[model samples]
Target chain A: MTTIQNRQILLAKRPAGMPTEENFSFVETAVPKLQAGQLLVNTLYLSVDPYMRGRMNDRKTYVPPYALNEMITGGVVGQVEESLAEGFVPGDIVLGNFGWALYNVAAAASVKKVNPDLAPISTALGVLGMPGLTAYYGLLDIGQPKEGETVVVSGAAGAVGMLVGQIAKIKGARAVGIAGSDEKINYLVEELGFDAAVNYKKGDLRQQLKEACPSGVDIYFDNVGGTVSDAVLSLINKGTRIPLCGRISLYNLEQADIGPRIQTQLLINSALMQGFIVSNYAEQAEEGLNQMAQWLKEGKINYTETITEGFDNIPKAFLGLFCGENTGKQLIKIADPAR
Target chain B: MTTIQNRQILLAKRPAGMPTEENFSFVETAVPKLQAGQLLVNTLYLSVDPYMRGRMNDRKTYVPPYALNEMITGGVVGQVEESLAEGFVPGDIVLGNFGWALYNVAAAASVKKVNPDLAPISTALGVLGMPGLTAYYGLLDIGQPKEGETVVVSGAAGAVGMLVGQIAKIKGARAVGIAGSDEKINYLVEELGFDAAVNYKKGDLRQQLKEACPSGVDIYFDNVGGTVSDAVLSLINKGTRIPLCGRISLYNLEQADIGPRIQTQLLINSALMQGFIVSNYAEQAEEGLNQMAQWLKEGKINYTETITEGFDNIPKAFLGLFCGENTGKQLIKIADPAR
Candidate 1:
């Protein structure tokens, strides 16, 4: 066993609104020799998700808020540098909810081994990981997209939204995407095979959405809420289903943002709107991962990642999520496997 | 075939914000000779519900908006004077979606027979009628109040809401009601056996709700939307369920009421908020009706009616729902059963 120097990022303070660089701090620490039943894993890829912004705030959401000065914890794909328990391996790839550090020391059972032969190891933090399962359960279980129905996804180019649109297509539903940039809109329509993609940045989102979905939206997989959601709602058909995955648009606001009360619209339409987090389906993780992997194998689904290299870029990559900067899964490349 | 004089009400014009007497017009007409498969129903009790206010608007909802110059149609309990249908009857109590008139001529098959001995005949339009069924399916089917959970119901004094609170109690759940008046607060707690009652009209709804529901709200049966809903949402427990039955507060607003968006609140809680109308469970209507009837017979549920006497008072009864003037089901009594 050997002690290794680690570089980590910490939540310096709770953000007032849109977070700046000052909200995060960098530190150098030493990882002690692995204890019994623990594995020493060197970080390879660290996920910087929009949900992390929620954790930074000192408020209890689906998960506990991140502690001040503590290393931020998130999805990490890394190679085991040393092991002391169970299926012993020196160069095995694994995934776990670990720290935003160059290296992590965790219980051997706390992480799951990732097959290097399946796909890129980085996918364990992206399309094949938490985002994948989130898209699977949130869309299939809640959205329940039926054939010939139109499914509209906000944040269509983001990690979860893009997968939701593709899954909607796999269910034989018309996938229409609502995104902020023309680049993302094109990527959704041309690359991901979305039936149509609307650039919400252009004014008259209602008119654009109406044109894109002439039959009206049957399911709205919402990752970005606020005015974008309001416009999509205006065109929702009777019996519409809204899978409220995230509200990246309103996450950073210092004060609460107000919009039209949705109850009347929901009542008149006889619609269903449900909010969910990925861990809500923890018991069914294997089912979602297997199905998603099968879809990727059959060429029925695709994925993308905006990787920022270096250990210090995690906070910048995370803040980029709110500005609609990243196209798909935003990740940081910390190190490479020594295999 | 004797022609019988009748007093019918028509939608004179669509309401702008709040409906007034002028928006409705009384038209003297005659009951035509009964056609084959038709029954002559002498209106005994006409239901004036908050949902009727939606029909007064020109916009399309779950049901089409009532067209100007057309007779207002809703739930009516009446005595069948003559029938040319297969189920021939000279004097039989029945229920149908009929005109707001002294007598209604309708296809006999379109109406269902009401068992007067099961309870009171008027209950066919109150506790055991559309309002009853609305509360039944909306609460049980959507809210799914599990035992020991706390259910907070807004518009607790109204037709659907009072039953919702009682049904929550019947399920062994804690029922907390939000009503406008102290009188209704007393009725909810004392008469209906609610665990607690908050008078929203007295203000400090958040504090009252916190005190009333120390366990936090597991289910919310929303009949009145706007600020009342916003307050209830603030105290929702994880995995909370919201059954959006009606938004009486927003029904008459000329301008859309803006409030704090709820997507974040819902997402963090992994909650479900579904909007529903009674007819959505048309296939299961018998199941719901049978269950509700059983509860009523066992005295597990109690109901009250604020009766407005005379045919001309129908509009006043309907209008009173907005001002919280009535308790339980607001009803208009036009006549006694001819039988």
Candidate 2:
């Protein structure tokens, strides 16, 4: 018989501005025994995405908001430590929505075991996972990039943006990436084969973008919506498609305030701007992942992750995304090398 | 041979706010005989739509703005008094982009001869024409309303809104029309088969919309985009489709003004709001007109035209739309029957 245990990181309080070390309390207890049709998993890596910011608000959303004093939940890659399910056993690595904890006992249907021979296990949280699918579908399906068209992607050095720029190249569209730093810009253009990369922190973004895309923008994959999106809207051609993935700039602000007004321009140009959440498109995830995994295997796609060393550092890694501190996908390595 | 009369209305001045008699001037000239492949049409009914207000501005648009001291051009229904073209003959009713005038020579290709035996000639300027086709394609193709869902349409008793509400009903969806006057509301419900109609001038808008559409809005056909559209956005369901046909409320306002802020709610509900002009979909105009014609013959669709007495009153009718004075499709009857 397996012993029961509780290992978790509970939210100490709703973060006021930026989350600190005091916000997370990591605790350990007996390992929980699995029930019928359930499996016990030992956490390998936990994903940290910017969308998790909305969940902490305790407001109404497409999904339920995370409760105070509860464990923060997100996508996880873990090894099946024990199994009470029919098809799984010890040593099978699975990918699912396990949270910020050491061990998880979940219903069998909630997790999918990974094929490590096909791709690396960490890819289940990065290039072969939700972020990868988001880039693939949001660009191809919603952005609808045509050959020789100019594409502008905001958050160009992040997990989704890097892949989007590369995919635009594959589709014969010119990819222009917008990021926050010189290193990220160099990586996006020199390494990822982006046609151009603009550091938005620099002055005169509109002038820079005008110089980069003389023909004007056609497909814009908007990950960071604020002044960057506002500037890009002016450069967009008639019938341009803007796939709105995230609005990282507006996430922290709590009041009904206006920043950039785009509706007047949106109307004049007849551009199509659409907002999409990755999880809502789960039905197409398998198709997206299969294509992304193939690209990963063939060395056609690349990804980078800023790995935080402990379960206690999950909040730090998440908050780092807003400050432009993380280079690509951000993940937390929760487990120490031990049984 | 019919006399070629050069009759036109010129833009006298750019208006500061609402256009007045001082903004327009009428002139009549000696008739010049028609050239080969040209048809001379005696203008019967002249269309004065809200979009004509857009053409008055010096700014560039999908179509160029009306130049000062030039004839203001729009859709018209006329009787062909003379024809040098093979297809068009004398005594035939025709429709074309005939300017605000009494008699004009039109190119054979640009004018379509209307068969009065099939439908009323006035319909060629109203329900079976641009406004009908606009409402048909924008609602069904863009909005894509489903059965039992609530649809909210602004400018509820006007040409496009009247047709959109009827089209919504035909699709098995509940149509909630928003207009300014109680008379328009009564007409919308009693004549057009709207499920509900809201008089924005009378009561609390948001509360009334909530009461009318307790289930939340599914499709929003926005012809007037100021306060009414802002109110509708608050009551939209997740995945709601908005076909933004016009923003008549903001047409005259020059400055960046404040109204309702809706972007956060737009992200929260995962709704889509897209702007469109009818001329972009002109390729399908024949198909839309054919379907609309059949519906018109079956008594399934109805429209009203507020007929002004003369061509000189065109500015008054156009300005009345902004003041919420016109009851239905505003038309200027230029020809005197008694003469």
For all candidates, state DockQ relative to the true structure.
0.88, 0.46
Choose the strongest candidate by TM-score.
1
lDDT of each: 0.91, 0.83
Task: Report the TM-score of chain B alone for all candidates.
Answer: 0.98, 0.95
How do the residues A1-339 of candidate 2 rate in per-residue lDDT, one tens digit apiece?
A: 656666797777776555666877777777655689999888988998888877877677656778888888889998887789999988888888976888888888999988888876888888888889889988998888889999999999998999999999889999999999999999999988999999899988999999999999998898887678778887888788888888777677655545444555556677777777787678989989998888877888877888888866777888888899888888888763233
What proportion of the real contacts between chains A and B does each prediction keep? 0.92, 0.31
> Highest DockQ among the candidates is held by which one?
1
All candidates' TM-scores?
0.98, 0.95
> What does candidate 1's lDDT look like per residue over B181-296, in tens digits?
99999989989999999999896999999999999999999998999999999999889999999888888988868998888888889999999999998999888888889999
DockQ score, prediction 1:
0.88
The digit string of per-residue lDDT tens for model 1 on A1-339 reads 355788888889899999999999999999987889999899998998888888889888888999999999999999888899789588999999999888899999899999999989998887899999989999999999999999999999999999999999999999999998999999999999999998988989999999999999999999988999999988888899999999899889888788887877888888999999999899999989999889998999998999999887788888889999999899889888897
Q: Which ten residues in a row have the lowest lDDT in candidate 2 chain A?
A: A255-264
Q: Which residues of candidate 2, in runs, are more than 4 Å off?
A: A1-6, A16-23, A257-261, A336-339, B1-5, B257-263, B336-339
Q: Candidate 1 recovers what fraction of true contacts?
A: 0.92
